[model samples]
Target: MKRRNLLIAVILLGAAVIFYRAFGTPDQLATGAAMVNVTVPELSETANEGEAAFNRLCASCHGRNAAGQDGVAPPLIHKIYEPGHHGDASFLLAARNGVRAHHWPFGNMPPVEGITDPEIAEIVVYVRELQRANGIY
Candidate 1:
């Protein structure tokens, strides 16, 4: 009986999460503008390299400094991307495998091609620094 109750509780919790995700607040569903203002910070060597790579690979969609493009992609500097929520590994996975749209209405992200794991790591560093500088961390 205890196990059954625990399972029911878990199921309810999962349903609530799904409901919230599907019907998030207006801010989370915001579109057609830069979601947040981002503060730039000093970059380490690796981060600098990553910045260049990001410009080459991701900026067109994600926007300059990853502030996000309207009707394109969500900002990396937002609270949803803080390390506690979507951690570094999530970025790696997204870059490699893409992700379904849950937070925004921009639809799914396609897997980024021709980027190596090391480059993605550097990009994560660059983004993390940006997040920290902007108080998202």
Candidate 2:
């Protein structure tokens, strides 16, 4: 009975090792989580249309220059357009689902509900272009 129990424990331990190797450790998991939040740049084709759409929809508060509205809104340029807040995926999520400054305290950004997905994609393009023009990256 003792030998059998030891064998079972060894098998379980081996299985655990295999699982960890396949899935990674908690630290690796955390790193992946952090990576998941990283904002990627936008693709090239839609950049122009995005700029136009932005001018049409988001410019009033975000500004024609994306520099902020003094009392109304925050700048969507430079650091604010960095990974966490202005990444492509983050942009898509914000446009699609709407955001309220989950990562910042500047102020809550109201949802843009009437716009469609294609429009949001174009906005993403424009934002990427704006960031590049601003030399953010």
lDDT score at residue 103, model 1, on the 0-100 scale: 93
lDDT of 1 at 23: 78
lDDT string, candidate 2, 51-124, tens digits: 67777777776765566554455567767676565567877777667677654433577777677778887887
- The runs of at least 3 residues in candidate 2 whose Cα sits more than 4 Å from the true structure, single-residue gaps closed, are 1-45, 102-106
For residue 61, model 2's alpha carbon misses the true position, in angstroms, by 1.3
lDDT of 1 by residue, 36-102 (tens): 7888888999999999989989887898899997767988889999999998999999999999999
lDDT of 1 at 116: 92
lDDT score for candidate 1 against the true structure: 0.89
Candidate number with greatest lDDT:
1
Candidate 2 lDDT trough over 10 residues, lowest sum? 30-39
